[model samples]
Target: MSLLSVRSLTRSLAQRRLLAIDELCLADGESCVLTGENGSGKSTLLRILAGIDAPDGGTGCFDGRPFAWRPYPDWLRKQVTYVHQQPYLFHSSVIDNIAYGLRARGVPGAERERRVAEALSWARLNHLLDTPPARLSGGEKQRLALARAWVLRPRLLLLDEPTASLDADSRRQTIELLRTFADAGTTAVIACHDRDVIELAAMRRLDLVDGRIITD
Candidate 1:
């Protein structure tokens, strides 16, 4: 069975249907690049999958267990990670920020540091470890967010336009990091307008139009 499955999913706000996905399934270690225009429900689907928002009506299964429309269980929440288009950075050093999630989860001091280090290596942000968020560039901040998520080692990584406004070099770096995630067997659902992200080997393309998936 797939690690994540959604059946008859629908999300509506103020009586307007935002999404109506009949079925979607993601096997463990699989990844999909979600392409859609603004307000086309790409972000909504990520939010719902990440369990940050509840659907209007749906049946979702994680690891073969069922979940109704509501706040997710602690374990389920831990299994999903969502990075915003403009991820919020706390007022702190880069390394400190990356280590925040593990710390919150009460991961041991040594383990947190170790995982943070691994994340730095994964995102290639080691040099920026000690830098303050104010001093970092847009791409650096984006990388920092990705590293932060990496440290948690969530089962499903949701990225919302992670490379949206980056420079050429930054975009290249971001794409490389995503490729590393794929190589490591991390299941990721990336919602973006950039086709460059589709170059990742694990990524299968899916388009969202008028709140419905148009799979080919």
Candidate 2:
């Protein structure tokens, strides 16, 4: 069964239609990209799927259960995570930022430390462990954002232009980490135009036109 499914989805603002997806589905461990021109509703779709925004109309299901995004249920919140193009970070140290979610979820202190250490190594942020998240370089901040989410081991990840403004090396490192996430069975939907990201293993393309999926 699909991990997530949606049909007859619609969204509009100020009397302007934004999305009109007839049907869409994602399988467990699947990696897909959302491609479209600006205003084509890629971010809008990601926000709805991430439960950050509600659609005007739609029926959605996840893990064989109805997706009640309006109220944004606790179970779904625990299962899904979203990262913006310019991700947000706390005014705290990198290690603390990475441990924030685990702490909120009530993960044991030792386990949180272990996971934060693992994440730091995984994202190559060990060197910046004590640096303030807000003072890090763009790529460093992005990696921190990803590491923070990855530590939670979410089943589904929604990323908006994750590689938008990075240098070549930074982009490569970020893509490698994303590949690792996919290999570990985390379903991901990334909105981006980067060639490296588009060509990741087992990555499928979903092109949007005028807020509708033109090809999948």
Candidate 3:
């Protein structure tokens, strides 16, 4: 069975149709990139999939279960994770920011520390553990956001224009980290316009035009 499935999904804004997808499925361990022009509703789709926003109509299933987001809020909150294009970091140290989710979920202190350590090591931000995330560079901030999401061990990750505002070098670095995450087995749905990111292996492109998916 597909890990995730959506049918007849629709969303409207100001009485205008913003998105209307007939069907979509994500296989386990598969990664797909959502490509589209500005105002094509890419971010809206990601937000819906992330459970951050519910579609105005249609149904979603996760692992063969009724995954209508609102009714299964707890399940979605635990299993799905999201990172915005410009993620917000709490007004705190890097480690603390990364550990915030764990704390909110009531992960034990020792385990939280270990998970945070692993995330920091993977992001190569261990040296900046005590540094304020607000002081981080654009690339560093993006990495920190990735690390924060990485530590959660979510089944599916939704990213919205992760490298859009970054410099070339920083964009390259962020994309590499995303590739690494996908390689190591996290299901990712990325919405990006970066050409470098589209070439990653095992990544299927889904393009949206005029709020409709023309290719998948």
Candidate 4:
């Protein structure tokens, strides 16, 4: 069974149709790239898949069973995390921002420290750990956001324009980190306009047009 599946999904906002997906599935460890123009509902579909929004019509299943949004299962919650285009950090140190997820999941002191350190190293933000996240550069902020998601070791990750604001070098590094995560069996769905990211991800590309998937 697919790790995630959506059947006949549809949604509308403010009396306007936002999404209408027939059937989509993502296998364990698989990655897919969602590409489309503005107002194509790419982010809307990602939000639905991430469980942040409900579909007006259709069913979603995890491992062949109905998926529930409330009181999220620990296993499932740990398995999926979403990173938005504009990341928000707490009014605290960068270390605190990256450690937030671990604390929320009840990970204890030592383990939390270890995971946070590892994530910072991976995102190349080790030196800025004690700095205020708000003071960091745009690339650093994005890296902090990615580190937050990565430390959880999620089995599925949904990224919305992850590298949109980074410089060339930073964008390359971010893509490399994403690839490493995917290689370690983390399924990913990325919404992007960057050709480099799309090519590097080597994911099945889908185009959303006016709330519908456009067939090639």
* CA lDDT of each prediction against the hidden true structure: 0.86, 0.91, 0.87, 0.85
In terms of TM-score, the best-performing candidate is: 2
State model 2's lDDT: 0.91
97 in model 1: Cα distance from truth in Å?
Answer: 1.2
lDDT minimum window of 10 residues, candidate 4: 67-76
Candidates, ranked, lDDT? 2, 3, 1, 4
How displaced is residue 124 in candidate 2, in Å?
1.1
Candidate 1 lDDT tens digits, 1-216:
488999999988898889999999998999898888888899999998888888888898988888775767787887788999988899988888999889878999888888988888888787876788878999998899989988888888999998998999999999988887788788999998776787673347788986799882
Pairs that collide in candidate 3 are none
The residue pairs that clash in candidate 1, if any, are none
Task: Give the range of the ten consecutive residues with the poorest summed lDDT in model 3.
Answer: 67-76
RMSD (CA, Å), each prediction: 1.5, 1.0, 1.3, 1.7
Number of the predicted model whose lDDT against the real structure is largest = 2
- In model 2, the runs with Cα more than 4 Å from the true position are none
Cα misplacement distance, residue 67 of candidate 4 (Å): 1.2
